[model samples]
Each structure stands twice: as C-alpha cells, then as structure tokens.
Target: SQQGEEDPQALSIQEGENATMNCSYKTSINNLQWYRQNSGRGLVHLILIRSNEREKHSGRLRVTLDTSKKSSSLLITASRAADTASYFCATGRNTGKLIFGQGTTLQVKP
Candidate 1:
C-alpha cells in the first residue's frame, strides 16, 4: 500500500506542551506533506519535506523523514488549544495521487 498510517490515532496535550505523532507507510514516495484541518475548514498545508531530506522545521512544527524505513513523524512544539485539530500525512508518488492514512486527532487543553 502506498498509504501511510499514523500511530496513536489521537493525542492530547497541555497548552504549552509538545505533541508528537508517527506515521509508517508501505511504498516508496517522492515526498511527504503534513497538513492540518481545523474543525470544518479545509486542510491547510503545513509542511513538505522531500524524500532525500532527513529533517525539517517550520516555526513550531518539526518533521522528520526516513525513506529507508518508509516512515515519517510530525512534532508540534509549544502547542496551543488553538492547535487542536486533526493532522494528516500524505505520501506523494509517481502515480500522481497522494494517499492519506487515517489522521491523528490532537486536542490541546488550556
């Protein structure tokens, strides 16, 4: 399968804490993108790291990629209750379709 599945499926964190999630996939991919969905809003792109890259950071978000293991992880630092939402990882391949796994829901409490 080309899709990536995230572990835990859900996460809860304090307002000032950090949250981490892991995803594992079954095939080779060109790149991986992390997206955030806030309630009913459409998913907003958070970050994208290419297959050759190992790690990347954007503001409060950090992403790690391991092409050898066909997996990736997303970390949110100093999370806020406003950050409460669902996070999804999409694996992009030559097939032109991004396969998304069941997402991980994050709840941040104030």
Candidate 2:
C-alpha cells in the first residue's frame, strides 16, 4: 500500500495459531485490499475495505484499516498449513493506481 512497509517480513506459526500482518503506508487512499499468493501463483484478493470502513471480516479472516494512521492489518484465525502464503496489502487511490506493500511471508507449520 503506497509502497508501505510490512512488519515481520517472515513469520512461522503453528497450524492452529493465528497469523497477523501489519502494513503502514505513506499517503492517503480510497480503499485498501489484502491479497494472498501461493508459492508461485498470482495474487488472490482476500478482502477490500473502503476508506470509510474500520474493519471487515470474511470467514476466518479479519481485516482492519485505520485511515487516520494510514495503516492496516490482516489477521488469519485458526491458520492451517494450507494458509502458508505471502500476503500483501494494496492501496487504491482516486487516480485508479494501486501501490502494494513489500508483503509478509507466513508459514503455518503442521
């Protein structure tokens, strides 16, 4: 998101543990999105929350955005080995341009 920095570039957690990733951006955004990418595959959009929204959830995934801080976080609950992937946050502006974060690699061990 806006060429933001993601905390814990790499993370390893147990299968049942929850995984959390944080991203901080440099500028304002219209909306923010989280994506997941498997080993060598393309990114899959996980969730998108508008600037007006504070939080959103999908299944075991929770996403929170703080426009005030220009930051966001993604939380994966009850993580599984299959959840192992690289997660990225992308910020969209009124100009229709999207800037992505460096991404956080999560490894869920069985």
Candidate 3:
C-alpha cells in the first residue's frame, strides 16, 4: 500500500501565526487531501487539490501540489488557538481508499 509521510512530527506557534507542513508520497495518486483532527473530534477535510492542479486555496488555508516530485504542502495563514490539531495528508487511490501520513501536530497558544 502506498503511504504519505509528513515532516516535522510536531510544531508550535502563537495565535494569529502562520503554520506550514509538508507531505511526500510513494506512488502516483488521483488526488491529495489535507485533513485536520482536533483533540477528540473527527477528521475534518481541509482541502483537496487534484494531481494535475498546482495550487488551491480555501479561506485561510492554502495547498500546493507537485506531482513531479510526488509531494504536497499545506499552509495555514494567521492560525488561531482553536486551530491546534493534528494535520494529516492523504493520497487517494482508484480503489477509493485513502492512505494517511503519520501527521504533524500543531499547537497554537493564545
């Protein structure tokens, strides 16, 4: 099974700061998605950028894809304390299964 790996196992930042995380995958993928998980909350989809797409943005979230490098990145602008959570990158396959990365934990202090 193909898998994605996130860098900087953890991160810390003050409220209203910016946070950046990267993800690298093993094989070709249909799409790459970013998700956020709060302490005890379910994973919430942050954004999805297709393999052919270079970049996408949603509110304060920005995502970039590099198919040639088999990598992707997520940037959160002006992050808030409520944004403290675990971020994961998922590679979607034709089978409809998503392979998740280990994740990056971000702590935002108010």
Candidate 4:
C-alpha cells in the first residue's frame, strides 16, 4: 500500500535561504526519489537514493535516507524564487511500484 507523509505541508522562505522537507514511510523500499512540480506542470525528478545509500546530492539538492527509521529528507541549498514548487517523495518497492507522499508546497520569495 502507498503510505507516506511529508512534514510541513507548506513552507515559505526568502531567496538564498535553504528549504528542507521530510518524508516518512511505513514500509521497506528499494529506492526513494524526490520530485519537484512547478504549479500545473509535471513532476521533475530531483534525486534518487537507493536503499543501500544514506545520502545523495544533485547540484543544489541534497537527499538523505534512513531505512531503519523509514524516513527521508530533501534539502535545497541557496534556494531561489524559481525553486518555488511542490516537492514530493516517492518510495519504490521490489515490485516496481512507486508510492508517493502528500508533498510539501514551498514558496521562495525574492
């Protein structure tokens, strides 16, 4: 079953500050992915960290996963107004099924 939740349903920050979002899942996962959706647009893949991995980074995006705790966090450093979007964390299982979290809406003001 898809069971996940992201903390801080909404966040507001100034440009250049960092934004962090947390996600918690109820089951084991093969891999975890973070995505960004700009308003009405499709989700843009941000980063993916495997079950064996504890942390990963892509450009200004950083992701950390704790399988034992069944939780993950996404951090965006030096956030920009353009970074304003909804962020989601999805868990992928051995069956190739992906379960998504509710998402965190971020607003970066300039």
Candidate 5:
C-alpha cells in the first residue's frame, strides 16, 4: 500500500528563499527518510529521522516527524537554483520495502 503522500504536489521559490514541503503517511514507521531527485531521476538521500526522534537537521535540510500524527515535514533553507528538484519522503519497513511519497517539485529561480 502507498503510505507516504506528499502535499501540494509542486512548489516554486526564488534563490535565497526558503521552501517547505509536507508528507503524510499511513502506518507506523521504524524510520522516515527524505530524498531529493533531479529531473525526475535518481534519489539523493537527504536525511532520516527515526521513530523515536522528533526532528533532525543536515546542512540546509531539516526534517520533522510526528509518529503520533503519522506525518512529517521537510524544510529547505537558503534555497538555491541548484535546489530545483523533487523532494520525497520515504517510509522504511522491516520487510525491506521502501515506500516513497508522491514528491513535491521545487523550482528555485535565480
């Protein structure tokens, strides 16, 4: 079953601005991870927050998880044109099946 579902579906921002995207999932998760994709190809692992964790940050990326709410949010600070890509939230299962969010497309204009 598809669990992680990203909101808005798309986003646009200017360089230096901030971009925020959200994800909502169905079942309990062991760990939630964020990924970035360029031109709809390949996935770059951004950050991962465990079920026991509430929040985490890595460089320009910040991730928050609320297992109680079965949701997560991703924030990108100081956005750059290079940041133009699609962001997705993924749920990891002990079964080794990784479910990915639909994705939020972000276009950072320079």
Candidate 6:
C-alpha cells in the first residue's frame, strides 16, 4: 500500500449535499492534510489535523483522523457546484515532506 491513498476513487453529489472522502496511509505520520485541486490549477490546502488531534473543522470542511487505523476522512458540508474538484490527502513526514494520496475526484451537480 502507498503511504497516503484515498478510497472510492471518485464521487458525485448534488449541490447542497454533503460529500465524504476517505484516505489511508501505510506508515506512521506526524500530521495529515487535505487539499483541493481545481481542473488545470494548483492545489489549495483545506485542513490539517495533527496526529494527536482527533478532529478539526474549517468553515464547511470537517476532517477526522484516526491514528489507530492510519486513516482519515474529509467531509464537505453544503457542497456547491463550484466545489467540484479533486481532493487529496497528504501525510506529513518528519523530514518536511508530504506523501500525497491518489486523490478522489468529486463532481457536485447544480
């Protein structure tokens, strides 16, 4: 398994619905971060949850981390059509590098 890999490959939802995505990592990590990438654009950091923290939230985004299972989940509340993008999970290493997940493509319909 890769260091940071996301499940469900892709997801589609109607506007105003909630979107949930999951990620799993193989090795130990200091923190896990989520990023959103629009088509043909750079990634935008969404949230970062430390190993010691169980959960964190930023506006419409909610993240949950489970160090025991080596997994994390991202929840986007009240999703909008503009929210369509690819979401990736990144494992923060001690060496100041991040191992990114394969990413989950989300399509929010209007």
List TM-score per model, in order: 0.95, 0.97, 0.95, 0.97, 0.95, 0.96
lDDT of 1 by residue, 4-97 (tens): 5798699988999999998998988999999999989999999999999999999999999999888999999999989999999999999889
User: Model 4 Cα displacement at 56 (Å)?
Assistant: 0.5
Q: What are the candidates' C-alpha RMSDs?
A: 1.2, 1.2, 1.3, 1.1, 1.1, 1.0
TM-score between candidate 3 and the true structure: 0.95
Q: What are the runs in model 1 whose C-alpha is more than 4 Å off?
A: none
Q: What is the alpha-carbon lDDT of model 3 when measured against the actual structure?
A: 0.93
Tens digits of lDDT, candidate 4, 37-91:
9998999888999999999989999999999999999999999999999999999
lDDT of 6 by residue, 56-103 (tens): 999999999999999999999999999999999999989899989999
Clashes of 6: 0
Which lDDT value does model 2 have at 4?
82
What TM-score quantifies how close candidate 2 is to the native fold? Answer: 0.97
Could you tell me the TM-score of candidate 6?
0.96
Candidate 6: which stretches are off by over 4 Å? none
For all candidates in order, the CA lDDT equals: 0.91, 0.94, 0.93, 0.94, 0.91, 0.94
Kindly report which residue pairs in candidate 1 clash with one another: none
lDDT of 5 by residue, 1-110 (tens): 28857886999878999999999999888999999999948999899999999999999988999999999999999999999999889999888888998999999999
Model 4's C-alpha root-mean-square deviation from the true structure amounts to 1.1
Q: Model 4 clash pairs?
A: none
Clashes of 1: 0
Error of 2 at 109 (Å): 0.2
Candidate 1 residue 74 C-alpha distance from true site, Å: 0.4
